[model samples]
Target: MTTIDDLPIRDDLRGQTPYGAPQLDVAVRLNTNEHAFAVPQPVIEEMRKRLDAELSDLNRYPDRDAVALRTDLAAYLGHGLGFASVWAANGSNEVQQQLLQAFGGPGRTALGFGPSYSMHPLLAAGTGTRWIGSLRDPDFGLRADAAVAEIHRHDPDLVFLCSPNNPTGTALDPAVIDAVLGAARGMVIVDEAYFEYARSGTRSAISLLPGHPRLVVTRTMSKAFGFAGGRLGYFAADPAVVDAVQLVRLPYHLSALTQAAARAAVAQSAALLATVEQIKVQRDRIVDTFRGRGVQVADSDANFVLFRTADDQKAVWQAFLDRGVLIRDVGLAGWLRVTAGTETETTAFLTAAEEIL
Candidate 1:
């Protein structure tokens, strides 16, 4: 009967918890911020065809650089973004890890605004980089001036800015990104995992990558493209920045099957990505429903909403679970998060919430 204490692990990781949200068995699950829609049938058919084409090559290694996939990703991003400026891996978490591995480690630090994607700090920790939790406005928003001040104060090796931030569901103002890029001495990584679901006018930091070699905008197919199961995440940066991650990433990190499926999905982008608008609609509906009942709901640009539980947060979470709907308790004392699921799923969540409250 050996325990972790007996096995001799890294001193820093001895007591640290792994990053995860609860994956429970429930009828309506809006907990993980995953797109409620599955990949459309046409895209699935396209993938099956592409995968079948790759069967003969399974014995061989995939392209280590994933060049074709990178090319398609570049075309998909389309801000005059080219293949050389993009990088991909299993998921956005791996992309962040590779960035941290390249830029952050022993004696280095990474800073993030609090209540953002929790993984920012955890990823930094896993890479042995110090993590800094900076202050955000009471409403979980980051102002440009304050962000600049914090960057100056910490002067970290890497700064993570999560747009349409998780658990809080708010987008960072472009001004804040500008100020941080101007003031920070290290690389700035903007996590845009929910970019596709943002409001119509939400500006992406991808547009800022031209002259700023240190700025990286990471995105995922998990949310909007309904490719979470496909596990594809990528980032757009200066080609030099893209090259730096290559020095740290595992060789041939993406498999042929993944590349094939993602390429097919991108090819049929219109069909697979058609659900974004509908998800946004459901998101707005959830926000309205909660607010109509006098609950404090955060304005979300992502596919999820964060609402205040105020008192008895755990009890409320349990009540929703008991009713067969699952939501996220983001450890924010008085707040919980629910993803913007499909119309029926959204209605189930609302009805369960109404009954619970």
Candidate 2:
């Protein structure tokens, strides 16, 4: 009998941990940047109503292209961002993969700014593409000069920009992003997974799509739309680019149930907007609380706050866990990230931090 180790594996995946969020059981969980609220009753009822209608079709495969959902998504985006075209996947993660499949492959490179989303490199690896992470400045802002120079040097096939980025929770400057875009010879994918939580007037690269054929902006319902478990995300790009993603996507990827659920959520955008407002309030309060206690916090435009602690980051994480709180220990060595939850949970997190710090 052959031992398992004797079997050949993909050379690229010899020692890789696939992309995933942390899983932990804690009373006041703030680790994964999930929305602190549930889908509103009206949205739930609407979903149930649509599901009732679609249950008859469960015996068959879902619409291969999810055309109706796409139309609804376009309408939803038009209402929110004043843009009318959109495409989607099971989650933004899948959308990201579709992007790689379209524009990146073996020998081509996927470039990303450092301390941004962790998924870019992992996805690139899985696609047999080279991944390059360029470090940002100490404040987590993109170094426009270095980035432009590197883009010219590497000439990557794809570049990922996570605005109001993860872990550090900072947005890339519009001017800097524009410079990189100008210098890039390939597709630029901007992940706006935290858009709703960002302050008003924060610029979105989506607005620049008309002039940039190589740009795509991806958004997720998991963060601000309170649909993490529902696993829905969408992207807006040039129709040609959207067509490229359509080519690589699996058949019937979005189930009828998921379509119903997403449609329901989109139909009730007002409620989601209200909840986003509340989360922003809580987020601002958390940032203030951390600053008052002398904890250096990143100026976040997302629903989470990242702070630096002089104490051992691992020790701080353990202390929070020991106190029934759960927060993400980002790889920044001395930094940790906590999501904005309900008022009570935020208070508990503060209390736990007070003890841990």
Candidate 3:
């Protein structure tokens, strides 16, 4: 068989692994940070109606701009944002990739704090951009001074920040964002994919968009709306930034079915998003359970918890899997991350933890 190494490919990607999680068929799978609920019936009904309406138009390409969908997303984001300030693609990965293509490719560079979203750097490499790896503090906190110092040192063309960040489950201190905006000379991309689950009073970067044209806040329906299968991720930025991404975005990149399904989900947002609070419940339960057991745990503003393992994380992870409860290893030494599933699933994980942790 002709292997990838046998064929000519990008030298930078010769040994690279594609981003993914363990997609195993387990009894209680909580490895990916997906909402544990099925799509709400109301949202499904709305989607079915909208999709049926679009069935006749399947012969043509989707709305190249996805105008109506963008308008609905703007309303959902609501930092006084309008359709011009919003853009969507297959996922936040694609949204960030488009941004990188327009702003950070070739001679330019992109930087993200470590143990942040793993995909940021991968997306950079895919775009021929140099990836600058930075770090959060020892406690996985991104302090303003530390963040600003790193920003000054690299001066990358694009900066990626994740709020209520993945794996670690911590929200960025808004002050760090303020300082980075003051210090960085290029575009700032804040990944707020878990924004809805953020603790109360956790301000969004969206509020800071008015005077800061270079700031972009990317979000997804995947986490909060149980819309991962829907493949809808979007960002809010200055209209000029939207125009820039459009230059790199594939024409009719979003399919008609996607636009219809996602818009329907947004229309039923109130119903679809009630699950956010429910997930938060399970998240806090996980946090409390781990902490009460005297295990070190990160404070979480997202629907997952990161906690230390009693032994090698891989062994502990395997132990959990052996018990029919699968969670995330996240490549963090001595630690593991697990999504907040439904009550029964969370209980199953906790039951496994009793023996494994």
Candidate 4:
């Protein structure tokens, strides 16, 4: 009876598709750019103790500001950053949503360099902000001068810069950030979701926060920290900018259990993060092996590699899937992304590629 066009929905959302990666059943899944390692047992035990302690207060609201968690996050970041300069949410997606809500909406505009993070435009649209897709170099690099010129052309209310960009797996040049901040008249958000995996000599935008109040640098515990299941992400900005987001965030947004779990994870970060270097080794090995075999592999500072296939990307992806390995076909014509998984997972993918390609 209700099979006709659905009841009233936002005019902007009529034909929109939700953002997601395929969740398929496979033996070796290297699709989502997740850390290949498991959380250390000691960290899990600590989180269990913390969560068990919080079970008694289920009736009461969580710390609305998540002050203790923020303090720990501040300490973890250690760029002279403090709790007042930090904010946290369910994940980087939620953190991005809060940002768009605070600074973007009807009559506002947000800009992102094309092929960076797909979620940038999606989140802007969800917030009712006009989304402008800008350009990048042929190699997917965002050069500073060209980037600054585009910022001048759009003059949007908000801008997004993704370092170690998704689907491309390359780090941004710090100068591009400086140029955008200088040329743009509004808020600039540098999404550093993969910052922890960046190669040496890579600079973080958090270092630029001392004087620039308009910049926000977002990070997550999902990647290098091995806390994806915990659903924790955060950002660092000026105290004033941090306070502005409070105008839009739901009261008691983070649950007590989530906060406790994240706190325990952060406390054991050293042990949890020891796998980063090991993962990096496998990542470099992937690049070298792929390139040596004549596949075009993009230089990567992130924990994944974006390689160009000589054959159809869909066919390649499916071939990998058929062989019990899963990687992302990011819709680039000749490209696919593979997360830097464990040594065995990496070997399985390479072995599959050798046979299939």
Candidate 5:
């Protein structure tokens, strides 16, 4: 009989490994860029109440469209970011997949700047689309001239830009984004997963969606909202673009429980905003500590700061782990990305670094 190992896998997935954030039971956990706080008690209590109300319907299928959650999300964006339209999935990762399914597939290409979000290429591979990565300049900023040239050359079906980009935490300029939009021949997806952390003056691309039919801006509750475990993310775009994403998503992708929890989380946005403020404070403190120790740090707009040292990255990571402080290695050779943790955890991390360095 033919065994599973003997079966031919898809060509695109031949050598690809699954992507994941590191898991470690260390004292100061900063590996995955998660928010440094927990969801407030008020939000949790509200979710509990809503869950109690929905307990009877647990046996039934949830709203396939998650209309209530979407309505709440739209209102949240309107108040928070001046965006009026919204579409969601179980998480932003699913939102990414939906966009890829809607705009790219076999023979088509998905273009992104390299070392942004690693998931873009993985998603493209899963969809059988050609993934093209254009490396950013040494400063970790996109070269708009080169990007435009590539857009003119490849004419990709989808292009992804991550603001306050992951790992590096660098925010792209609005003018640069507009230049790409002007040159793009197809859909442009802007991943604003760290929008709240990006204190830069750069505005969300959602504001530009009215004139650009091909633009979509995706946001997540995972970062600033302190709800990574909740797995709720939404996107704002032209209605037509939103409808396209809705078409390809599976029925009941967002559970009734998830919807209830997300609605409660939005209602308590004020508290979440406060927590984000605290994280920012901690982030600045960590950055100062790194700089004081003679480390070179990237200018960050996210909850994390990336610092480069003369020592090898993996060596630094291993050193920290050995000392019970876990930070992301990110495989950038000599650079390390450390997420802001609580006051206690941040202090522990700094002390560990001082000893290790």
Candidate 6:
């Protein structure tokens, strides 16, 4: 039997683990931060119609630039953005990889606050970009001053900032973004995959795009739009940035069916995003439930709750699985993360947590 060790693979990827969470056959699976609700009937019907319109064109290639889909994404994002300022791909992960390809490569560097979206470093490594990591405050928050100090010290070619950060649901203060933009010499990628679930008045970095061409705010339809299966993610940036990324984007990267369905979903945004408020409710419940039990819970602005598990998070994770609930153990000691699922799922999680966490 042959293994990767026997193949001629890149030395940098010799012993790295791939990024993933368990896709288990459990009752209440809340590991990935996926929105709990299914696509509404009306939106589903719309998507069906959209996909139907593309079935006959399957033999032909899609719009090379995905211009129509980009237009719809721009409208959905609407911070005075036009299609020229937007781009889309299969998912936000692919979009980030393209950004890395365009701006980061061998000898260049990417910097991020640690315990963020784990994929950032992996994407950088695959692009041959050196990754520089800095830690967040003990409270799982990043201060503007601290963020700026690290950026000035590293001056990396790319800076990755994740809001409502994963593994710790705390949202970054806009001040940190402002400070980093002022200090960093390279591109700043803001991952807002969970922003739609954020508490009220949590500002988005999209509002900061007017004067900063180097800032990129990436988003997805996976969470709020419940279009994860459709796999659409995008970003809002200057037209020039769009031009740069296109240089590396694969030809016809987004299929016609994906483009049509996403546009249709955006056209019926009201129906597609109706579950956001309800998900936020469940998220708040998770936070309160855990904190009430005297556990340390990070204040969440995303759909997941990151709380301290008793000394051994792995055991706690297994215990939840034993109870037919699946949560995430993000390689952080004594910490586990759970997505805020439907009310029933939340109840199941809380019931098991009562016995476990």
Q: Rate the local accuracy (lDDT) of all candidates.
A: 0.91, 0.86, 0.92, 0.92, 0.84, 0.91
**Could you report the Cα RMSD, in angstroms, for every candidate shown?**
0.9, 1.9, 0.8, 1.1, 2.1, 0.8
With candidate 4 superimposed using the best TM-score fit, by how many Å does residue 17's alpha carbon deviate from the native? 1.1
TM-score of each: 0.98, 0.95, 0.99, 0.98, 0.95, 0.99
Candidate 3 residue lDDT tens string, 109-180: 898998888889989999999999998888888999988889889989999999988879999877788889
**1 versus 4: better lDDT goes to:** 4
**Model 1 alpha-carbon miss at residue 258, Å:** 0.7
In angstroms, give how far residue 337 of model 3 lies from its true place.
0.4
Candidate 2, residue 164: how far the Cα is off, in Å: 0.8
Residue 266, candidate 3: how far off, in angstroms? 0.4
Q: Which of the two candidates, 2 or 6, achieves a greater lDDT against the reference?
A: 6
- For candidate 4, which ten residues in a row score worst on lDDT? 1-10
How well does candidate 2 match the true structure in TM-score terms?
A: 0.95
Residue 232 lDDT (model 4): 97
Q: Which stretches of candidate 2 lie over 4 Å from their true place?
A: 1-6, 79-84
The order of the candidates by lDDT, greatest first, is 4, 3, 6, 1, 2, 5
TM-score of 5: 0.95
- Runs in model 6 deviating more than 4 A are none
TM-score preference between candidates 5 and 6, better one? 6
**Residue-wise lDDT of candidate 1 within 239-349, one digit each (tens)?**
998889999999989999999999998899989778899999999999988898999999899999999885788989998999899999888887889999989999999
Cα error, candidate 1, residue 77 (Å) = 0.7
Model 4: CA > 4 A from native: 1-4
- Compute the lDDT for candidate 4: 0.92
lDDT of 2 by residue, 204-259 (tens): 87777777788888999998889999999999887788788888998888899998
Error of 1 at 217 (Å): 0.3
In candidate 2, what residue range of length 10 has the lowest lDDT sum?
A: 76-85
